[model samples]
Every structure is written in structure tokens, then in C-alpha cells.
Target chain A: LAKTTQPISMDSYEGQEVNITCSHNNIATNDYITWYQQFPSQGPRFIIQGYKTKVTNEVASLFIPADRKSSTLSLPRVSLSDTAVYYCLVLFSGTYKYIFGTGTRLKVLA
Target chain B: GAGVSQSPSNKVTEKGKDVELRCDPISGHTALYWYRQRLGQGLEFLIYFQGNSAPDKSGLPSDRFSAERTGESVSTLTIQRTQQEDSAVYLCASSQGQGLYEQYFGPGTRLTVT
Candidate 1:
């Protein structure tokens, strides 16, 4: 099982870049790292996914080093709307199961 | 196309009562998942169903919780003798396939046990 850990909370001002890192010391070789953002009273929404290196989508970017033991989610020029709980999940390909972390609460102040 | 949807946006039940929650996945989705989220907590995997395979109940908290799915279309999660600890948001998600695909989530059903 690939258990992930992230910071409990973070605060960032509007228009600033925010980076949330997750540690997964036991990540498997075929495990894929994915990120999800959730707002109050709503289900989580997918943000980005990556196996290694970096993957940038319209909403966010995911960075993973060679060891694949950790990854970082980068949100550029965050706004108030970006305030939500972000979770780092490890997708086990063999079992097709997802293990979610406690998540990082990001508060973007305007 | 419509996304994943759950019924009875909110449900409140008394202790020791039985409650059932429903989930409707996307049209062609082959994988469905159930999860629970407590107040200010991350999602907890409950169960998973893929096509006609046996539903994965490894994540279920106890025998009081059971789920069933019919032909990958709809799924129902039943909690028997509900307790205060079962009070949380029950979420449903579906994906095109079980692999490394993106999961679309529903609004979720808030289950309140009093």
C-alpha cells in the first residue's frame, strides 16, 4: 500500500504561486500519483496526474522526481476560488484501488 | 452527458436504523467507487465495482456496511444499524476504466445519524 502524507494546511495570498508537496515513501513501481481538489459540500474534482517528472495541465502542474517517492502540486497565480482541500492519492494499477491522504487545506486570501 | 449522480442529496436517520444510498454512474463508465468523508477529513475508500467482477469490499469499515451493483449501472450502499460514526458524506465516482483514468464524482449524499 502506498500511503501518502501532506501538510495539514497552507495559506497563500492572491496572485501568488502555491506548491503542495506529498510524500509517498512506499510508492510502488506502477503506482500513479493523482491530485484532487474538493470544496465544501461538494465531491472532489481531479486536478492532475503524473508518474514521474512533471505534468502540466490547464489548471495545475505535478512534479515528481526520479525516486518517485514524493511529488508536488503547483498552482500558479492562485485566486480566492482556489481555496479548497487538496488530496494526494496513489493509484495502485494492479489492484485498481486508490488510497487518499489526509489532504492539505489551502486558503487563498485576496 | 450527465456526470455521476447520487440520490437523496441528504439523509438523516436515527441510531440503529438502516439507511440506503444510491449512485448512478455515467453512461459508459465501467468502474464505480464508493467513499466516505467525515467532517474536515479526507475521503475513505469504501468499496469498488468493476464491470461484472466481484465488488471489492476491502475498504468497508465493518459488516454493517454492504454495497451492491447491478451490471455496472447503479449501485446501492446500505448501512445497517447506523451509528454516529456513520454520519458523513457518502460519495460516488465513476471512470471509463479501472486503470489510470480520471474519476468523475457525484455531489454525494450527506448521511446524518442522530
Candidate 2:
């Protein structure tokens, strides 16, 4: 089952910071939260992942609280090319099935 | 160093005909997965394979859908008596490990059933 839920869509302007939050209330202790960014006609690309605290990469950052009930993906600066669907996935250690909830459509406007 | 690869980037078939899709996961990656995404919809998990263990087919919509993984590399998803509803983009992914690791996805195969 899909354990995460995110907003249907969001809009942002160029050079703005966009934060997309995902809620996985029943997340298991062993589960890890990962995020992927998908562009038109292409596969989803791994952006960032985190178990707790925060993880920052060249492209994005992932922040998770101690409770792990929810997580946020932060994109520092937005551009027109950054417009795509962002998916939040709950990855279970035992089950290889990556449950992807309906992702948030991010539109970066100029 | 190659990522996951899938065959026949696009396919169009008659409603009653059968079709086969192939996926070649990253070398030495222990896990492979299949997912279907329709237009304007989230990905729907189809199946998963890890190592030599049995595959998890719970996500498959019907018995006509079956997949097989050879060793820890190549995998194939076959659909018999395809229906128009089966039209969607089939995506393949693999991870070095499950859970704690992130999955790398391949360019999906667009299937159009008529």
C-alpha cells in the first residue's frame, strides 16, 4: 500500500525555494523516505533521501523530523526546467516494492 | 556503469494480441521492479524481484500478467490477451539494495493498445 500522501499540485516562481511535504503517518521504523523528480517523457530521477534529520545534495535537500511522520523536499532555486512531478516514496527494507503515492505537480513559472 | 534499460521504447498492438516487455537492470543490482503509469496518474506497482527469492506479484492487476527474472539481471513482463486498458507507460527500475537505497529508473516503454 502507498503510505505517503502529497499535495496534488503547487506553483512557484523562478529563483524561489519550493518545499513539497509528504505525510506518511503509519511509516514503519525500518522504512526510508525517498523522493524522485520526473520530467515529461522521462523516468523519475532520484533527488534525495533521508531517514531522519536532513540530507542535502547538489540538486535538492530532504528533511525529516524525529517522529518520521512527515518529510519535506526542498529545492533551493526554481527554473522552468524544474517543472515536473515530484513523487514521495516509502521504501521498506524487507519488501522491495517502492510504494509511490500520487505525486505533487510542481510548476516553476517565470 | 549503465543504468536500467528497457526494450522496444514504444509498442502498439491490437486488443487481443499479446505483447512482451523486457528490462535489463543495472549490473549487479540485486533488485528489479516493474511499474505502470497512465497519463496523469501515479505509478502503479506491477511486480518486484530480489535475488533468487520468489517475486512479489500482488500488485499485478490480473493473472494474464506475469514476470520472470533471470538471475539478478534481466527480467521480462508479459501480458496475454491485452486490453485497451493495458495501454500505459511501463517503467523499469533497479536498486543496489532495497529499502534504504534509492531506485534508478529507465526510460519507460510507451504501450498503446487498440
Candidate 3:
């Protein structure tokens, strides 16, 4: 079973910064939080990943608290093209049992 | 365009028919994975293959679903007697020997069982 949970849907404006939070209270020490973005009719794309602290990439930023109970994905200057499903996955690298939780659908309005 | 690729972008078949989906992972990726996605849902893990190690088939929903990958290369997912519930997008991904590497996904095969 997937151990992560996030909002079902969210809405944002084109130029606004969007923040989506995921809760994984039972996250393990070896687990890493990875986020993926999927557009309609396309496979999911890698966004950002972090274990603790923060990790930023060209696409998005992943912020994980010290407790690792939750993490947030921040997108800056969102656009209509950014509207898609965002998945938060908790992966145990040792066991490799990667499960994708139901994603947060972000609809960007112009 | 060095990325994963799957065959038969769209396949429509009658119930009880068998279907084979193929996946070609990135050139040097040693870890390949298969997943299923229903409409407006997250991916469901199907199988995983790493190098020459035995595939982890723990996620296969039923015995009718089976996948094979040869020497960390092209992989094939074969479903016997496909059911209507099998109608979904089959996605394939690959990473460079796993371990904290992000998986790269393919366009996926949309299977519709009529």
C-alpha cells in the first residue's frame, strides 16, 4: 500500500507559486520523498526528490522537514502547462518497494 | 530523444484476448519497471527488473499478468486472457542501477479491452 497522502485537487493562478503538501507519517529512515508530474495522456515526469532538508531542481523544489513526516513541492511562476497531476512517492531504496500514492491534481487558471 | 519507448501506443482488444506490450529502456539503464495507471489515478506497481537479478513479481495483480526482461534490455509484459479491468495505461520506466536515481518513464501503451 502507498504510504503517502496528499490533497485530491488544488487550483492556482498562472503566475502564482503553487505549494502542494504530502503527508507520510510512517515514513522510514531509508525512505526518500520523490515527486512526479504527469500531464494528460503522458507518463509522469520527475520533478524533485529529497530525504531531509531541501532539494531544488530546475523544475521544482522539494522541502522535507527534519521529522520527515511531511514534504512540500513548490513550483514558481506556474503556467497553464504546469497543470497536471503531481504524485508523492515514498521509496525504500533498500527494498525498492516504490509505491505511487494518488496524486494532487493542480489546475492552473489564466 | 534518448528515453524509454513502448510499442503499440494504443491497443484495443476484445475480452479474453492476449496482449503483449514491449518496452525499450534507455541505453545504459539497468533497472526497469512496469506500472499500470487507470483513468485519473496513480500508477500501480507491476514489476521490476534489475540487471540479471530475478525480477520482483510481488506486485503482479494476478497470475495472468507476467513480464520478462532479457539482460537488462527490452522488456515484454504479457497478459493472458485480458479482462475488461485490464483497460488502462501501461507505463515502463528505467533507471541507472537504481539506488536514489530517478526513473525515466515512457509514453506508455494505452490498452482498451472491449
Candidate 4:
């Protein structure tokens, strides 16, 4: 599995855009970049996923550079309820396992 | 319209006891997964099942942990001789299939062993 590195925590206020980046230098050609949001005492929810370039959904957007070695999750007009831990995972090829790193904790302040 | 569901939302057991955690995936979902989240720690991959085929048990922490899925609907994770270290939330998720699908997770079963 590809190892990912991200910030431990981040702070933001409501109505501001929050961007979290993840680095996966050993990403494989068949690997996909996926992001999950986890609130306290709940399971991680899927936010966005992308193989390359950009993919936008109703909730968030994922931007992957041409190199596919890194990706960014962009959330617009954040609110206090958006405070949660964001995980960037690299799904292994032909396997059921996805390696999750420490993840970036986004604290949305009022 | 129902999402994934897990039974025994919270379980308290003694050491050396056995516990079973159940997961009901969304209807039509073919891929199911099991993960463990210890306090102050990241999610740990446990196992994955696709349809009725053999599950990938490589991620299981020890021989004491095991899981079984019936058809493509329900799964049960069994822990034998549970230890204090087994205290954590066990999460279950299901996806449409491989490549680019978003996984839907259940609320999970919080197990505490004393």
C-alpha cells in the first residue's frame, strides 16, 4: 500500500474554504486517491475520490496533479458542523485493504 | 433507503470472552469491509469480503479475530478470547465494487473489554 502524509490538524472559521493536501510519493498506477470524513464516535464517511486531474461532487472536490503523487480535498463554505478528521487513503490494487494515515483534523471554529 | 446497520451498538465484556459483531450492508452492495478504530488512533483495516468469495483476511491483527459473510448481505466479525486491547470501535463499510466507488460506513459497534 502507498503511504500517505498529511498535517496533524488545521483550524478554520465558518464560510471559509478549507483545503487539505495529502502526499503519496509511492502511489501506484492502479491506485486511487480517496478521502473520508470522520466525526466523533462515527464511522468515516466518503467525501470524494479521484484517479487524476479533478473530480467534483455535491459535497467536495478532489484535485490530483498530473503526477498523481498528491491530491487535495477542497471544501467550500465550511461550517462548524464540518469539523472532523479527514483521511486520505490509497486503495491498493487487487486487494481489499486501504492504508489510512493519521489524517488531518479540521477544527471549524465558530 | 436504509443505510448500513450494525448490531449491539455497544458491548461490554470480560477478558477471555468471545464477542460477535454483525454488519448488514446496504442492499445490492457487493463489497464489504471491516475496520477497527482504537482510541486516539487511526482506522485499522481488518478484512474485506466480495460477494460469497473468499475474504481477504490479511489485515486481521491476530488469529483470534475472524469474520464471515453470508452471500452478499450480512457479515459477522468474531473475536475469540478478547483482551483489554480489543476495546475499540469496530466499523463496517460497503461499496458498489472496485475502482472509484465511495464506501458507505455504518455507525459501528463499540466494544469494551475489561
Q: Worst ten-residue run, lDDT, model 3 chain A?
A: A92-101
**Docking category of candidate 1:** high
lDDT value for model 3: 0.91
Q: Model 2, range A17-39, lDDT digits (tens) per residue?
A: 99999998877788889899999
**Model 4 alpha-carbon miss at residue A30, Å:** 1.4
lDDT (tens digit, per residue) of candidate 4 on A36-82: 99999888988888899999999999999999888999999999999
Measure candidate 3: CA RMSD. 1.3
Please, what are the lDDT tens digits per residue for candidate 3 over residues A25-72?
778888888899999999889888889999998888899999998999
TM-score of 4: 0.95
TM-score computed on alpha carbons, candidate 2? 0.95
CA deviation > 4 Å runs, candidate 2: A93-96
For each candidate, the alpha-carbon lDDT, in order, equals 0.93, 0.90, 0.91, 0.90
* Clash totals, every prediction: 0, 0, 0, 0
Better candidate by TM-score, 1 or 2: 1
- lDDT of model 3, residue A73: 96
TM-score of each: 0.97, 0.95, 0.96, 0.95
Tens digit of lDDT per residue, candidate 3, span B1-114? 389999999999999999999999999999999999997788988989999999889889999999999997999999999999999999999999765789999999999999
Q: Whose lDDT is greatest here?
A: 1
